[model samples]
Target: MTQFAAEMIGTFFIILLGNGVVANVVLNGTKGNNGGWIVITTGWALAVFVGVVIAAPFSGAHLNPAVTLALAMAQKFSWAKVPLFILAQFTGAMLGAVAVWLVYKDHFLKTPDKGLKSAAFFTSPAIRNNSSNFFSEVLGTFVLIFVIFYFTNAEMGNDKTPIGLGSLGAIPVAFLVWAIGLSLGGTTGYAINPARDLGPRIMHALLPINGKGSSEWNYSWIPVAGPLVGSALAALLYLWLRI
Candidate 1:
């Protein structure tokens, strides 16, 4: 598959399953209803695994824009290709979100709580503290990109090259995401990827969901900016350590 198509398809699955779990748990009624935090985290981890396995050979599975930025910053990926990769990631994320909504349309209508409906589309802070929320995202993403640097040993480029162990190579990243979600996700839902949060959030605003309420645009920047800042910091640190 082409890199663009691979990224789009991969992120499509990420949102399809990741937000899907939220819809199943938070919406009015479903088999996974109230499956709780562990279920949500596990679902997201598996989503990452699936996405990475599908896209790694073609796009290095930089399904998250923060990851693409960090790879460029670390000199492992081409700056020239950054924008294309990011566009593909966002496209895939938005499409994935739409798929989730379609799959859970009935439940979305049944769920009266606007917040619950929004939860299936984007992340929101458990407690709204701007600085604290930003810090949580930054720290969570720092852990993500920093660890990923080590995983690739600073050598994996965004070019279409197969990653190690094929499908099994995706495991470490899945576990890393799971760890971040379990340990640090409570504060701000661990929106460690700009495209992952903002893309679907845009969709939440545009889609015709009943009583979906405000898109929470005011607080949207943190998820995008925080991850970018964290990614740059992690890349800088990795470069410095190498030096």
Candidate 2:
């Protein structure tokens, strides 16, 4: 597959299963209903594993814009390709969000709670403090990108041959994500990836779901900006450490 196609398809699966779990848990009357936070976190980690397995060969599976940005800053990926990769990630995420809505349409209608419906689509701060919410996202993503730097370090040389996780590499990454969710996700839902949140948030606004309520545009920037900032910091630190 072409890199763009690989990225798009990979991220599609990420959201397909990631958000899919949320819908199954939060939306009404599903088999996985009330499966709880562990289920959601596990689903998301597995979703990352699946996406990485699919895209690692062709695209390196930089499935999140934050990841793409970090690699470029760290000189592990091409600056010229950043925009294309990010576009594919966002496109895939939006498509995946639509797929989740379609799969859970009946439950969405039955749920009746607008916030619950929104929860299935994107992250929201549990406490609604903008500063804390931003800090939570930053710290969560800092851990993500920072650890990813070390994960790739052994294989990454001057040529940067394997810039992202391989199929086996997905295992550690999955555990890393799961750990982040279990430890730090409570604050802002740990939207450590920008495309993972914003693309779906946009879809939540556009799609016609019953009682889906406000998309919370006011709080939307935190997820996007926080991860990007976190990524930059991680990349800079990695570079400094190497020097």
Candidate 3:
């Protein structure tokens, strides 16, 4: 398959599994309805694993716009490829959100809490404030991408790494995601990746679902903008500190 196809498929599963867990946790009632933070973090880590495994050989399985941009800034990835990768990632994320809606349609109708419904599709804060929420997102992505840069440099030189983690990297990354969520996600739901939050959010607005409220456009920019800034900074810092 071509790079676009690989990227689309990779990003599809990333958001599908990532947002799927949120839906399972926050929807009216289900097995994972009350699964809590641990579930969400583990699901996201597994989602990354799945997408990376599938797209690693063909396209490196970015599945994240911030990641694409940060790598481009580092000169490891071509600027020309960044747009196509982001497009594919967004498309895949939208498809994933649609799947989540279909699977949770009945529960969505059952849930009267608009926040819960929105939480399943995107993110909302336990405590909503502009500066704090935005800073949290930036810090989260900075840490996440900093670690990513470390791993990429450690394993794959300056460019993006191939995704086959051989079941070894899985536990560690999952644990790290778990730590991030357990420690930091409470305030703002840890939307450290732009695509992870925004794509599903767009779908939340577009999809015909019950109890869906305003897309929370007011706070939407934080996740996207903060992560980009954070990831870019992290990449630069990593280059200076580690390289």
Candidate 4:
């Protein structure tokens, strides 16, 4: 239960801050309106840092269900706990999206572009290329989870808790996310966490956000399926390398 709450809280902040940046940048009249990609990515990176720091002690900060699934596949985490962790992450993400919606309710009203409003809650492909978009997510998450496997290894997090990266500190994991965002995120906004994208997306569908656009359900499966596939691949490689 402690672990569950930890992940839930961590994911809540993840969406609140991560999506909050999008709302600020894209929504009309916000101070951060038109802040650009760097601002959004940077905000998400910092959000991860803070959230990981908060959840590390109790849950190892597997705020993303993809990470949880990958860890279990690599034999670092137990299968029994995967469902619980994923549920917590999704619940937390939904609550966080709700917070973002409420916080930016006025902004949503001020902003007339429904696409911008939807962007604040979910990821969409810049080009709408099915193969390329799915590939982008797969490649991005492979880097994320593969590198994550190395973070808590023999030397980096040495003498720290061996469970996960934050055992060393949250900064490295944060920096890892920052690097991924800066490098590979251009393709699909790097929806590396299924819960992060899907949970908020579901909220967008259910919420009464005056003019929120299509949830893009047709492309929805990419973010979820791609991350899971990529994480699984990362786990397989981790095992193959015996690292």
Candidate 5:
């Protein structure tokens, strides 16, 4: 696969499995329904592994736009390719979310909790404090990107692509995500990626599901803005450390 197509396919499975787990846990009457937080977190970690392993050979599996931006800022990725990668990630996320919706259509109709339906699509704050929520996302992404910077002895691939934990294999990164989800995800569900949250949330708005309720556009900016800010900070800090 080409780089763009690899990115799209990578992110497609990322959201497909990630959101599929949420739907399994929260939507009504599924076999995995009510599986609780550990199941959700574990599933997302595995989802990351699946996406990375598939896309790493071609696109380096950035999957998250924040990761792409951080690599660009760190001079590990070309600015020219940033937009293309991000577009693929967003498109993949949307398509994956649509798949989730279609698979869970019956459960969605049976489930009356609008919040639960929304939870399957995007993250929301447990406490709803804007500043706190933003900080939560930023902090979670900081851990993700910062630790990623030190994942292996090398940082960038030969052609200036961001080679993430892929160089070291997918297991370490999977554990990293599992750690983030278990430790820091409680507050804002640890979106840590602009495309991951925004694209699916957009689908939630457009999809014709019964009792799907509010898209929560008012708080949508936090996941995007916070992850960007955190990734930038991680890049800058990593650069300074190198100096």
Candidate 6:
């Protein structure tokens, strides 16, 4: 597949399973309604694994706007490719959210709680404070991108390495994601990926669901802006630290 196709396919699974977990937890009549933090984290980790497995060969399977932007800024990836990746990711994320909606259509109709319905499709902070929520997103994305660079350098291995190494590298990355979610995800659901947070959010607003609440418009920018800034900061820090 082409790079664009790979990115879109990768991103599709990321949002599908990532937001799928939220739907499981927050929507009515789902088994995971109260599964809480652990479930969401694990689901996302596995989702990343699935996406990477599918798209790694073609596009390196970024599936993340923050990752694409950071690698571009660091000159690790071609700047020209950045826009394509972001567009693919956003479109894929929207498709994924549509899938989640289909999977839970019955539950959405049965559920009367607007907050719960929204949570099923997207993210919102448990608390309403903007500063704390924004900071948490930034910090979370910082750690995510910084660790990604470390792992890429340490374990991605040379091209001479077997394809299986890519699969193996995913484990540590997945675990790191799990760790971040367990620690910092309480606020704003640790939306450390711009595409992951915003794409599905747009879908929630556009998709028909009963009793969905205000889109939390004021807070929406935090995840997208925070992760981009945080990833850049982390990239710079990694360069300094490596030196």
What TM-scores do the predictions have?
A: 0.95, 0.96, 0.90, 0.95, 0.97, 0.92
**Taking the tens digit of each residue's C-alpha lDDT, what string does model 1 give over 73-123?**
877777898888889989999999999999999999899999999999999
lDDT score of model 6? Answer: 0.80
Per-candidate local distance difference test: 0.87, 0.89, 0.78, 0.88, 0.92, 0.80
In model 5, pairs of residues that clash are none
Give the poorly placed runs of model 5, Cα more than 4 Å off: 154-156, 160-162
Model 5 lDDT-worst window of ten: 159-168
Error of 4 at 172 (Å): 1.1
Number of the predicted model whose lDDT against the real structure is largest: 5
Question: What is the TM-score (0 to 1) of candidate 3?
Answer: 0.90
Higher-TM-score candidate among 3 and 5? 5
Clashes of each: 0, 0, 0, 0, 0, 0
Between candidates 3 and 6, which one is better according to lDDT? 6
Clashing pairs in 6: none
The best candidate by TM-score is 5
Weakest 10 consecutive residues, lDDT, candidate 4? 154-163
For candidate 4, lDDT tens digit of each residue in 155-176? 2322234345455468887888
Worst 10 residues of 2 by lDDT: 153-162
CA deviation > 4 Å runs, candidate 3: 151-172
Please give the lDDT score at residue 236 for candidate 3: 88
Predicted structure 2, TM vs. truth: 0.96
lDDT of 2 by residue, 1-243 (tens): 988998999999999999999999998899999999999999999999999999987887789998889889988888999999999999999999999999999999899999999998999998999999999999999888888886555326334344655423788889989999999999998999899999999999999887889999999999999999998998899989887
Q: Kindly report which residue pairs in candidate 1 clash with one another.
A: none
Off by over 4 Å in 1: 151-168
Error of 3 at 56 (Å): 1.6
lDDT of 6 by residue, 1-243 (tens): 887898888889888898888889878789888888788889988888888888777776677899887776666677887888899999998899899999989988978989888776567888888888888888999988877776556324334332221333666767877888888998878888888878888988998777887777788899899899898997788677767
